[model samples]
Target: MKSYEYIEEVKRANGLDTDYKVAKLLGCGQNKITQYRAGQTMDNETARQIAEILDIPVWQIIADMESERQKDPSKKKAWKMLAKLSKQAGAATYNLLILNSIISFLVIYYAL
Candidate 1:
């Protein structure tokens, strides 16, 4: 239902005793955990890091963030923009890795 509720659910699901433990595992401050508990707008990076710490897919965290954003209504545009940017960045990174692999292959092939 709410952000805090979701976090608490996950925390319990993973056998964690407190949100502070989750925050510490995430390498973030307890204030950040409090914000999560209070329902705050978490950026993509924070969501990703939290997901990693929680041993779940990053999309799950993003989905929770998206759900919270949708509830706010006013956050719709901003959330969409960030999602688009994250997608584009992921694509660009994939393309860069492919290009690098191709260059590396070519360099080795030509040298041999």
Candidate 2:
């Protein structure tokens, strides 16, 4: 299931016509939808945006087709890496926010 197939499945499931509605939901131009439907390749950013709009797991949609092309062991490793990366990235972002807040507090205290 390529991203395009995944998208079409979503549209059919939702009973939507034309890629315009999908584009609106995804905050992209209608042409992007057309390109996807036409089987033109899209970058990861665009694929992520579409996944966000459709409320689907980005990896699930993007990896479905690619995973089928890989050996079972390799595909499993890829999934594990994806999960680990997502978790680590989220934690790193939260840590950054905490650090920023501490720095801000220190700055304010010194100023006072």
Candidate 3:
């Protein structure tokens, strides 16, 4: 499952008539949708929007496509790097959110 395939699946799941219209709704050019359907790379924003429109988790779509990409021997290195980066970023972001919540709680408690 490539980006295009994911987009197509989302469109189908949402009962969308045309990829062009999906692109329009996502605020991208129609050609972007066509290119995605043709197996071209998609930006993260577009991928997120497609996931949102289909009511699916963006990570689920990304994970499915990444799994498919990993099946190709040539992409193994890239896949590994991507997985490492995703993990690092996810952990860092979660930690930041936790820290922020703690700080916010402390501020409110001190004020009270």
Candidate 4:
């Protein structure tokens, strides 16, 4: 899909039918909706919120961004690498934190 259409596709992927519904959920307005649908860039918070709405990992959001804007070779390559690294590191870090917490809990329980 093209840059302008990725959001719509993700929206459909998430079972959301329209930008209005997303806007309501996002607490934004039609202009902001237009920006999203127009494929304008957004910050990380907005990206994460959109990912939440799209029910995809944030890396997928970064991929969507990279996929849409492939004209700039350097930027695209950089973001692609960043996204790939972020996917690996982010998931590993998250899982490790969870595992560490569980291990800590188990240790405390056993000690008690």
The candidate that wins on TM-score is 4
Give the per-residue lDDT of model 4 (tens digit) for 1-112: 2333645655676677887776676677867768865767655566677667654467756675764567888878777777677667767877898999999999999999
Candidate 2 per-residue C-alpha lDDT over 1-112 given as tens digits, one digit per residue, 9 for 90 to 100: 4557756765776677868876776678988878777766556776677566555556654454444445688785686566456545656766898999999999999999
Worst 10 residues of 3 by lDDT: 55-64
Give stretches of model 4 more than 4 Å off.
1-17, 43-45, 51-70
Candidate 1, residues 1-112: lDDT per residue as tens digits?
A: 3457656755776789987887776677889879876768677887776556555556655755785668566585566566556656666777898999999999999999
Q: Model 4 compared with the native: what TM-score?
A: 0.60
What C-alpha lDDT values do all the predictions have? Answer: 0.69, 0.66, 0.70, 0.68
Tell me the deviation in Å of residue 17 in model 3: 1.6
- The TM-score, computed over Cα atoms with residue i paired to residue i, of candidate 1 is 0.49
Q: State the lDDT of candidate 3 residue by residue for 1-112, as single tens digits.
A: 4777777776777688888767767888988888877777676677678667765546655654565556677686566556456556766777898999999999999999
Positional deviation of residue 58's Cα in model 4 after best superposition, in angstroms: 6.9
For residue 51, what is the lDDT in candidate 2?
61
The residue pairs that clash in candidate 3, if any, are none
